[model samples]
Target: MKTLKRLIILTTLLSLLSISLPASTLKASPPHKNVILLIMDGTNSDILTLSRWYRGTDLQLDEILVGGVRTYSDQSAITDSAAAGSAMATGVKTKADYISMNPDGHPVLTVLEGAKLSGYKTGIVSTSPVQHATPAAFTSHTLSRDEFGDIGEQQVYQGLDVVLGGGAAWLKPQVKDHTKDDDGMLKTKQFSREDGENLVTEIGASGYDLILNRDELLRKGKSSKLWGVFAAEDISYELDRKALKPAEPSLSEMTHAAIARLSQGEKGFFLMVEGSKVDWAAHKNDPVGMISEVLSFDDAVGEVLDFARKDGNTMVVAVTDHGNSGLTLGNQGTNENYKSLPAEKFIEPLKKAKLTVKGATSQLKKDRSNLKEVVSSYGLGNLSSGEYRTMKDAKSMDDLESEMVKLMSKRANLGFTTNGHTGEDVFLYAYGPGRPSGLIENTDIPLVISEYMGFSLKTGKFADWYVNGEKFYRDMGFLVEIEGRTSNNPVMVAKKEDEVLRFPENKNFYWRNDEKVGLKSVNLYDGDTFYVHVEE
Candidate 1:
């Protein structure tokens, strides 16, 4: 009996030891200390090979791609800005039209919010509007992609460390008469209209240094928060901007400025830098514009990579949301004579001719005219009348563009796919801790970042209430109630429950009784909580 009692005690102790050892071992190790998400909107992976073949220069972005993970969305052959951006931001595959919302229209928390909650400073920098889909999805939650005004407003509330981009009009008050038609809404009140205060000023009051142009941006400064808006719309593509306005700073300059500000935070920072105009050039089927813009964005990537190298622990991930213009090399065209045309000769004389197509055509008729004189003067030898007529009949920019491509292809390979997006697998490159050793799917991005940031899938509200296949807000301890929409009746208690509740009957209840149920009104709630378990 004494021996049996002693054996039983030993067994009980061993059982407890087994349980405790696993628990101790399961304690997660610290995650990567720093992370940077680099977004290259609509840049295709194939563009890298094409750039080296045609330009004789390998892009810096290509260097990162050599070792990084590359993946595509599950459903679409091609993805839109909203879908791709949302998937990357939230780490889940969603329908194409949704922004930060999940496929079922449920709001999804973003990596930015997760980073912020984890005590890291967060910033968003882009060449496009701050409220544009890519940047907005990472920082704000909205049901529709068209909700720029609301997204812009939400940026202020996010308390982000920095925001740099264009779309000043979205941040400025609308002049009743000057307000343009926005998504079918007539001019009423401007979403951002205020007395003399632009969006920058408002953000500045919240402790951000607002810089308007390149000069101000480059000025050395020490501030935790900075907002720079360079244009009223998406900043111009590199070629167009250089031709149209040479004074603006390049994307690299903006990126450098953003990094300088965000790195100053005590805790590490999360900064998103976007190369936005590549998609626009692709949409216009402008090969020259696409090359110039993509190269310029690559320059910015080089800047970030250099900084991340020095910072050591900072992980930088560069990827495009989708591909545009299905660009591809084609067989050589027959414009052999135009191949030797010097760049200066082709572009300069057009400038000197006061050359609107209309003006040039009218002038060409009066004389075989200074047409040859103008061409030869610019060093482009005399052209036949047939060639002159081809230039004369250029009806749209595309007509003139096609001729230029044929001419330039003789000197360099050119490619195109009508002006539309293609469903091509994009590239993702990452360096630093928590990044997988090899290529990963698009859905894996959020998981990787979350692991690095030390956020368990279980800690997020969405993870438990929705993702875990469990009931929602009720588990968080809030009463579920349905208030009638379009009816002025005061919200009366619709239902009450002790355990987790599901308000399947009222999908729009939270939308109506927002103030009462604490949608945006309060910062904290008291209630029984459900814990979700996720791998770090």
Candidate 2:
């Protein structure tokens, strides 16, 4: 009887020890430290291959591919912005058309929210409207991705640390200019609909310093938050925007600015930067435009890579949601001049002339002999007289685009299908800590990030949990004490009941709101717990 009782006690003690030890103590080290997700919307794999061929050397992306992974989702092959971005933001795959909402229209938790709960600062930057699909997925949970107005409103309430890029008009109320419309219907229509307060004003009121231009963004400031808007809609493409605003910051500039601001947090941060126009150019089946956009996006990638290399712990990922316009390399042409034309020459003259295909063709006929010279210069010498006549009558941009395709096809061996998305799988590149050693699917993105951040998925629901330090625990449920040290030194304690507590300089921690009384030291203790109270 005595032996049996002793055995039972031993078993109970062993069980308690197992419960107290962390699961990681028996496992391998966790992967990455910080993660930076870069979305290149509507970019296709062919663009990378073509770019390599055109440059006559391998690109930096080729090196990244060696350490990266590529995998598709179980969702629709040709995914829309909302669906694709949501899948990348969250681990689970949902049906097409849902943004951050679940299949049943219920709101789903995103990695951004998860990171915030984990005590990390969060930010989003994009060339598109800050409320646009890709950025929206990380921050807002909306049933309809088309709810731009709602998304814009949610951005303000979320208290995100940083927001940059265009879409200013979406945040401000729409003002109807009756005189500009040249019609009286403006008076009868509901003209003064409130689209919520100006995003700049709301963000300012929420504690961010508003910076409208590049200079302010680069200038050092003490504010913990930042909001910048450069245009009313999506910022113009790199080539076009530079011609318009020489001082306007490029995508790389915006990315660097975001990182600089968010990295202030002691617990680390999560940021999303997007190059959105790659899809727009692909949608038009404009090879020059698409290639230019891809290269511009690559420059931004270089910026992030540089930062990650210095930080050592920052994980950087570059990927596209889906392919567009089924671009293909076609049969070789006989015209030597066609093969000799520089890639820029084919597109620059057309843009410079500002002559629509119909207008250019019409103007060409007025000077009939000049038509051959102009067309031949573009390497479209094979264009028939009938084709020129048809082009002359073209009435709209679409018609001109069609004629331009035909003419360019004769000179350059290239082919494109309908000007829309395709079902092809896009490429993904990842570097830095926490990434697996092999290729991974799109679903693996959220999982890898969550794991690296030390957060676990509970029934695929991450809405309520937060991560702190190397552990992902539930959010502070009822105001428990929080404490941290800067240099991992032994925590100091008060020597006397009336003596002031002194904290070491440069330590980082947060205390309860009510315990923020005057302090002799930076550190203060409430009852048995030491904390450093900080403003949210």
Candidate 3:
């Protein structure tokens, strides 16, 4: 409440958005267009504030704190990521393991599917495997989120405009290695799906451009349908990802690319971007890792906000599915009379961990590996005998990582009650058109988006207006023209060579002649050369 109170008091926080059209204007049934929903899975208000404070970066999401949302699952108050995300995606309560379905196991349409059906382009991006619960709920449906193979099948067959994330193992082929110890270290790993279809290959065969690394992502064709998978499973946690694999794009980069591709269409778009590993880090109770992940997620939120600020019609929703591990700043500090303490000291020791707990634990499974040396690298050499055994003999990666994180928590003076989600409501923020107001139920999420579309646009019509190089102002009324070629001009938007421009005002016509005269643009890429005049 302290941090939230600060946010409420700060005038700058609420200044991110102008007031929406008056209540009277909304009665006209004016259609709302683009929407971007960003979920930081398994996060709570504690992580949000600490990340903003420790990282020292000005996250734009902090300036738009709208309210909080209750996160109870259909069957229980203690909601897992799958159920919480499903509630948001489908506007219905669901069982703990379900994805995009009602509690009765019936397939419920998601806002993404609604957008697709209504002719709006759809996309999803995540730091975890795309088949993971958070991202899965938006575009795929199943009684269980564990159905990774099934989820991957729909990810391709559904033919979204853009899909980017890790979790390539679900869609691609893999061979098992039995030679290694079977202590559940995934030593014998295989990923070829049971259906025998390699969706990664099929994605390219189906005319979608498949990208595997950061460079390819940035250089991907704007006109090409895109499917980019950065890692085999979860993208490495932010703490060690860049240092270990520089080629993989960050969360913000993926968000930017997904928007770039999806926004190519005139019908508008619905995109869900998840900073998924925040929950994983939280589940392990690794405050340092959690902070970095939160900051990373917030960076992506900043990207979406940047786009929304420029494109007046877009709405941005930022929320966390639930809280995790019951993290607090410090037990030594209390209300009102709390002593000022050194947050940097705690944050600095976390810097010693070069790899995520999961990554470091995997490195220790080798024959000559010294657990002491491995733990020491993360400032955890003081583990007790029982704690040491718990770490060394961890039955699964989750156990191994959680045990290691517990050890690290002691040194940092941070306390964690459990290794799973807590029942607490989490922070939810919004800005721009169709923003959710006040405190809301988690199930109200999809409805907020659904209602914003106002009515389904069968033809995906947008009132696109062209500017003839003079001054133009954008309100929340329509889709306006993009950039000219002038470097200093704010009106100049980057144009791709193979772009197919849609002019909805002219019977939603597809304009594709770049070098042809009388067209709005040409191959020479000169904004002034080809100008379309307005007839009044």
Candidate 4:
């Protein structure tokens, strides 16, 4: 009788607690040891069909199709990468170009940051520069995606286990070479950072093995920390890389390498891999480049899925940030006989091309007199008189490349409505223990991952660790000023009686009256406020 009375009291207390809390707060599940998030940036759902047709087989993504995500920003119907990526990184929607900041302009903890706080290894891989919007949103908190210098520095101090992508140029400030190009004009390669701080040196000092080329990345052995920057900027598109054969590594190669390094940790890991250039190709309405990128991303997906299946304790989730270019398989030309038309008409035209429009344009001379020969040589065949004239009168390199791809797309029956992002739901794919299914909001992605990893983003020590530097000091009666607002380096200075604290913008260590104090996470300046992790 006493045991039955105790059970009744326990049930009554649980019912009362459930009524007091929100459903989201009550949701919980078993945690996975590892999770891999693959994002094909700016890919439309239809591109999967195009990829399937191009390969004559179903994709690794097709097998794990779970649901869809509603892609939109806090204020706009169509979301840019920064906002979309931020929504995925943090479980909140913000303005375009914002990274990990909420609509209220406050820095929020990301899933990766939360994972790090929970003692899990973390990494980010992308075909674009690692400091680009998608990857930056996960690892750093900033007001603008254009602030590559701040983002890059924060990432270095963020203590990520593995970071593999392009953008080595951002780590070092711009330096004039006083050299001339092939046209006898002075060539100036301007880097993005204004601080004059060489981060590559700092990365090495921080106990990371710096890898600059594909061979170095491939030959890398097991290590706790790895930083590989493949190119000066965004890596080449797959088709363009196939033609040019640059020394950069492919997305899958980087993913494979990151997993190899991250798996060495005992606490498990959270890895985000992005096929970053599909959006660029879609913005130009280049179908061939889009197809090539989608295929390349699928190859990376295959690598992730293989690992997840083998490990059994890992979860793999793949999705796109938003739709772009409104790519369709059939255009108005096929309207008359849509059902009767064979796949050969579409597949054959794309097969004839060996290089992307960008690659083909690179072969053009200064005068562009070899446009026809270059176009024909890339397998587009002899251009018509009207097509040649259209490309000949193009205003800029961008225009020339767009026109060339447009002409090729017309022959391939690929239709693109606009060169901008579209407001639409993107397909979601997942595989693992406790994978999310059914329709979900874009912001729910990180929440699902948080649940899968057994962490609480809504209420946790992660948020408490990062305090607003100015507010925290000001409340303690110290005078504070965030210096260098416009420059790449911003320092938070707090002054009190016979004591002062100097927190440099992106470094993990701060100074308290000549003594350096280290933090577990980096100090961040998000254009308006500075965030620093304070130990309890």
TM-score of every prediction relative to native: 0.69, 0.68, 0.73, 0.90
21-66 in candidate 3: lDDT tens per residue? Answer: 4656646654448999999888877777677766667567778898
lDDT of 4 at 93: 89
- Candidate 3 off by > 4 Å: 1-32, 173-188, 332-340, 368-373, 379-403, 456-536
* Shift of residue 354 alpha carbon in model 3, Å: 3.3
Ranking by lDDT: 4, 3, 2, 1
CA lDDT scores, all candidates in order: 0.61, 0.64, 0.72, 0.86
Clash tally for model 4 = 0
Best model per lDDT: 4
The order by descending TM-score is 4, 3, 1, 2
- lDDT (10s digit) by residue, model 1, range 1-536: 99999999999999888887876476865533667888788766555555454355677876766344333443576777887788888887777767666776665677777787678888888878888989988876566777665567667666788888877767766622222231212345434432233555567777788777878888986677888877766776665555444556688888888888877766677788888877776675545555666777788888988988888778778887878877654333524544564444333322222222211222232323354543332223455677667745655434644544444332343456556777766666776656654556665676678787778543545363323212344454556443332231212232335333222111112222334221221011111211121222
Q: Between 2 and 4, whose TM-score is larger?
A: 4
Provide the clash count, candidate 1: 3
- Model 1: lDDT of residue 409: 34
For model 2, how does the per-residue alpha-carbon lDDT over 432-455 read when each residue is reduced to its tens digit? 887644556666777778788878
The TM-score between candidate 4 and the true structure equals: 0.90
Runs in model 4 lying further than 4 Å from the true structure = 1-32, 175-188, 463-465
Clashing pairs in 2: 31-434, 32-433, 32-434, 117-466, 118-466, 118-467, 511-533
